[model samples]
Target: MVVRIFGISIVVTVISLVVAYLYGGVEALILCAILGIFEVSLSFDNAVINATVLRRMSEFWQKMFLTIGILIAVFGMRLVFPLAVVWITAGLNPVKALDVALNPPADGGEFFPDGSPSYETALTAAHPQIASFGGMFLMMLFLNFIFSQREITWLSWLERPLGRAGKLDQLAVVVASISLIVAAEFLTDEANRSTVLLAGLLGIVTYIAVDGLGSMFEVDEDDIDEAAASSGGGPSQLAVVTGKAGFFLFLYLEVLDASFSFDGVIGAFAITSDPIIIALGLGFIGAMFVRSITIFLVRKGTLDDYVYLEHGAHWAIGALAVILLVSLKWHVNEIITGLIGVVLIAAAFISSLVRNKRLAPEADAEVEKSTPVS
Candidate 1:
């Protein structure tokens, strides 16, 4: 499995190096490697969530995720999304935007080059809009998780209260809306406040639409039971084709993947302005690694083994959401964003270990009692 996961990584790296050498020699090759690492480190939590969703899906959809999904992730989000941002925010057509992205104007090493800004400049200028949209979507996703009434919880002290609050219908929407207003009013520049607010609202709408669609198509217990009965007397791990429900879920996952990549895409500019370099280095190499990680977690059932892993991933997402919003006003270190997730997951893992240790004794005693002198 390890080899399978990394086989693509090795191939991607080699291709990246070849592309880099063709484009800009050894320097571009090194940049590609670094960007790949950057994407993987920042997106570990994304893999966890993808696994959580992927495990529910049928084998066909799962295969689609690895095949067609990879193209959408690498090119659509990493390359085209950035171009779209430039085109929409800067009043350039897609073709022109693509051109500018490929050949950014010489900055003379200036952060904000003067007069008719380069592709990076235009894209970076749209950061407020991008951050607001992605941040709000992610914020809603996190709040919905915490507010959900669940049997298992890692941070019960906080989660329990939130879960209760979730009883208020559309509470996640309310919280997200308020958060967006606050961000626009206080955290964003006056010139871009409307843009931020609009983008943020669209983000909320997007999430609501996707989530509502998923709920509408969700397989009911009766349906699952019917499927089970058709097969045999009892429930079985059958690959029940969910059809429409499954397809919507795939859409949801794709949107979710986009939300996670927003910050990474913006942050890539901090490294270089060449869109090709960004796509090849981070999109091709790094995004592939993230995909492999998702496959690994799903195949291995790692989430089941580590009981609190899901909780940790959601917490990390919550942190990332908050960071994305805060980044509107402040320059957050990418490393910090990545580390927060790593630390939370590590802590949750330790907590799971302690929990298992405590439960083990009870299980042993129950087994001994049942043995009855056997």
Candidate 2:
């Protein structure tokens, strides 16, 4: 199962490495490898979070995530999305943007000899809007998770209080809205304030629309049992999603992937400005690796095994959202961003180990009592 899941990722990595070496010699190969590592480290938490959602999906949609989802992640988010951003935000046509992306400015830097910004420059220039939108979307996700009254929590003291406050209806939305307002009002300059606000608002709206639709289509437990009874069968353990629910879920995941890549996409330029190379690293290898981890976790029921894993992922997301908002005011290193997530997840894993050890005796007691004598 592991080999089957990683087969595609292995194939993509070899192809991308060959392509990268061909594109810009050994240097390009090295840069591509670095970006792959960078993305994987930064997004390990993404896999944990994705597993929480992906486990509920049916087998068909899981396959969809492996296939069509990869195409979208590779081409749509890694390739066309950047072009679209350059087109809309930079006021360049799609073709013009592609041309600029493909061919650097004559001087071989982020500016033309005539003093106009290069393609990389244009994309980076739109950082405020990108950060605001992606940050707000992720902030809402993190807030929703923290406020959700889940049975399990890693930091019981903090999460318990937050969950209690979550009883206030629409608290996530109200808090997210206020965060967006504060960010736009204080973090952005006058020239970019309205644009930032608009982008941030759109982020919130997009999250609500996608998440709400997915939730609306989800089958209730009682309904699932009733349907099974009508068909003359016992209640199935699995609530396998299909049709509209699956479709919206797939859409929601893609949006989530896009949101996570905002800082990553921008950070790639700091290493290398070649979009082809970025796509080779992020789309081909990095994103593939992340998804592979997600599938492994789902197949293994890792979330159930490690009780606090989901909480750790959500906290990492909250930290990233805060970092993104902070970036609007001051630059934050990509290394710093990635390290924080890695550390949190590692700590969570260790804590889960401790929890298992503590419960081992109790689990043994229960098993011994239930056993029958010969």
Quick one: best TM-score, which candidate?
2
TM for candidate 2 is 0.95
Q: Output the worst ten-in-a-row residue range by lDDT, candidate 2.
A: 234-243
What tens-digit string does per-residue lDDT give for candidate 2 at 227-311? 7777677544333444678889999998999989888899998898889999999889999999999999999999999988888
Error of 1 at 179 (Å): 0.7
Clashes of each: 0, 0
Across residues 1-374, which tens digit of lDDT does each residue of candidate 1 receive?
79987798779878887998789988888887788899989999999999998988778889888888889999999998888988987788888778777766654442324345578778878888888888988888898999998898899999888899999999999999999999998898899899999999999999999988877767767878777788885544334347666787889899999999988888888788778888997788888988888989888888888889899999999899899989999989888998998898889889988988989999999999899684
Regions of model 2 farther than 4 Å from truth = 113-116, 230-241
Error of 2 at 85 (Å): 1.1
Worst 10 residues of 1 by lDDT: 107-116
- Tell me each candidate's RMSD, in Å, in order: 3.1, 2.3
